[model samples]
Target: MGKFFYARVSSKDQNLARQIEAFKKMGAADEQIVCDKESGKNFNRENYKALKSALGLRAGDVLIVKELDRFGRNKQEILKELEYWKKREIRVMVIDIPTTMIDIPKGQEWIMEMINNILIEVLSSIAEQERDKIRQRQREGIDCMPVKNGKKVSTKTGRPVGRPEIKKPNNWSENYEKWVKGEITAKKAMENCKLKRSSFYKLVNEE
Candidate 1:
């Protein structure tokens, strides 16, 4: 049976060194480990997909991860992936969960399965909840930013923050008038104004 490891981080800037080192300590070769520097919010990651492909994993193989949360933050999706591997006769081992890393007696394997189910349910829910909390915090932070003259301002320096407002193009009036009168297509007007669809519509609404 082959052994493989999967590691993930939430963003490109986040480090994967710790997870890689842990996998190395477990005797996984560099080629046996797949890493993704992307969010765990879903299972659409590139490296993760490659790891789950027919060429990478097979029945009787073992898939190892540093933690269950690293596998995914979506509870239902995480459970679905687990079920997929289970049906294929592949073992998924999470290092942080001691029980999952242990071997059970052949005849009593059901006991371990029951315990694993309970732990997975609880931990996956917690991971999903944590992801929701993080999103809420980000929204709150944006809402709490001070606004000055209709623009968001930094709390420290009272300076305008975030994206600068898009200004109307010099030829906007002429192009927009033509577009409104059906003399020119919206796409043509946008091209003349050098603005994208969203920006063109935003300018139109403002006018």
Candidate 2:
């Protein structure tokens, strides 16, 4: 019924203007644009959760993104959502990486769809792997930087500050591992944690 656009920037210092411009150029209305000033490596963001909950998605609704990575760094999560939206007859368009859209008749060969789905899985897997690699390299680089009396100098803030902890549900880690091992149904997990089903999956499927 409506067109939705999502844009993300990893931190407060980064601006969403470029992505907003790109989405507007794609004909997305101001009201339809959703911006998340957070990391895509984690999907449990307030803005992302809001968009999913709104589910303004119907048969012909479209989801537009500036790039595929903007969707998320986690590949399996991306592929899962893509399949979910497709089943709902929602179209997702990534401007930077097109050709992700599949055009299939009402009744067609499932094999073709399966093959395309596999490609999405593979590409997303690669994206996740690359993200991990980048994180590892960043950690190494930070470690190699000169330290002053056991404290790393801050180039931006000019004051030594510890990396901020990402707030997560208290039992998220334990619950997620347990759910993955089939210790509990997703619904039971959510009930135990007082979270939603979608939140449970988002935590469990985290990279």
lDDT of 2 by residue, 113-142 (tens): 666666667767877988899899988867
The reply for model 1, stretches above 4 Å from the true place, is 154-207
lDDT comparing candidate 2 with the true structure: 0.75
TM-score of each model, paired residue for residue: 0.78, 0.65
Cα RMSDs, all models: 3.3, 11.3
lDDT of each residue in 1-207, candidate 1, tens digit only: 999999999998999899999999999899999999888888999988987787788999999999989999999999999999999999999999999999878899899999999999999999999999999997787789987799777787888877778999899899989999999999999999999999999988997
Q: Clash pairs of candidate 2?
A: none
Instruction: State how far residue 145 of model 1 sits from its true place (Å).
Output: 1.2
User: Per-model C-alpha lDDT, please?
Assistant: 0.92, 0.75
The local lDDT score (0 to 100) that residue 41 gets in candidate 2 is 82
